[model samples]
Target: GAEADKGSLGPDKIGGGAALADGVGGGSALGGGSSASSLALEALVRGVRDDVLALHLDVLNHFQAAQEAQTRAMEEMQSRQEAMASEVASLRRQLSAALQQRDEFRWL
Candidate 1:
């Protein structure tokens, strides 16, 4: 749906608008104050609006993808941190056990 809709926005508007806008010229589309001139202005406005919407969609998609990637990276980092914490706890327990054995031997 999106691909198809965006597909329409480009060629038709660029091609048609270029032709009509050239014919309509700059000031006449407004200064002429004719119904035909107004219609051309309306068409130009619609073309610009469509182009802006398409650009907005592109930016939004990029931002969403970036956010998703950031979320995945955060999750991976969290997992790594948790694993390191557990490993550190295990090493501390081992160190305590060694110290206890040394103290007992010293008492003998």
Candidate 2:
């Protein structure tokens, strides 16, 4: 009686041994059996793949937006720096001209 019970408890006796099955070819307890299990697994994989691809695309879009914003900021900074340089040059030229006029007046 004990041996009979043990045999019944073996992997093969349960779920058509589907749990112990190695791969797609392996049997399953599902009503449609091994093929159904394989199809279900494939569908799950495909769904995950699609979701991951969508997430990757969203990340890329965000990255591109950030890059564009940074570029604009850099360009604005560069333009401001150029304007400041021009102002400084103009101030220096005015100072030089004023100094030359003072020297001429001292000689007079």
Candidate 3:
């Protein structure tokens, strides 16, 4: 009867005396679990930061494209303005020559 009372169960058995004896009030029971949860939280924060950074890059790209298009339009307008100014100057010279010929004919 005493032998049966003192018999040792397998180490993996739940509620075994050996397992309870080993769990001598360790500082915190969930230390490993808490560390794992903290790591997961840090990972989530990093992922959100990366997403925001990508969005910012996209916005910057769009702004640069718009600026380039505006610059091109301005250059084309300037080119057209220069051509119109040259045409006006040429027409003024032709009008002046015609008037001078008409005055000489009237005097004859």
Candidate 4:
């Protein structure tokens, strides 16, 4: 049987030596795998960022629409309140005139 060669730095080297070096350095499987992983992670992060931004925009749009609806509702309520106030004033004048006529008739 052929003697098993440990690695580029030889079997006497400690802790898997030059074998692990090749795995981490250029032209090795680990190097290619590391670069591929980094690229994939970057792409995933960008996609997530874009998705979050889209969601934020959607939320802002909804809030703006709600604000506009609230403004319209407030305007309508204000107009109704003004109308009611005028009606109340007219009714008060009519009631006062009627009371004055009743008192005059009693006095006569």
Model 3 misplaced stretches (Cα beyond 4 Å): 1-36
Q: CA lDDT, every prediction?
A: 0.69, 0.62, 0.59, 0.61
Candidate number of the best lDDT: 1
1-108, model 3: which lDDT tens digit per residue? Answer: 444223323333334333433322231432434466655654555565556655665565566566767989999999999999999999999988999999999999
> Clashes in model 2: which pairs?
none
lDDT, residue 65, candidate 4: 64
Give the best candidate by TM-score.
4
TM-score of every prediction relative to native: 0.64, 0.61, 0.59, 0.65
Q: How many pairs of residues in model 3 come into backbone collision?
A: 0
lDDT of 2 by residue, 1-108 (tens): 453233232233334333324343323323335466567875565566556655665565566666767999999999999999999999999999999999999999
Q: Which candidate order results from sorting by lDDT in descending order? A: 1, 2, 4, 3
Where does model 2 exceed 4 Å of error? 1-34
> In model 2, what lDDT does residue 25 have?
35
> Model 2, residue 4: displacement in angstroms?
70
Task: For model 4, state the Cα shift of residue 6 in Å.
Answer: 71
How high a TM-score does candidate 4 get? 0.65
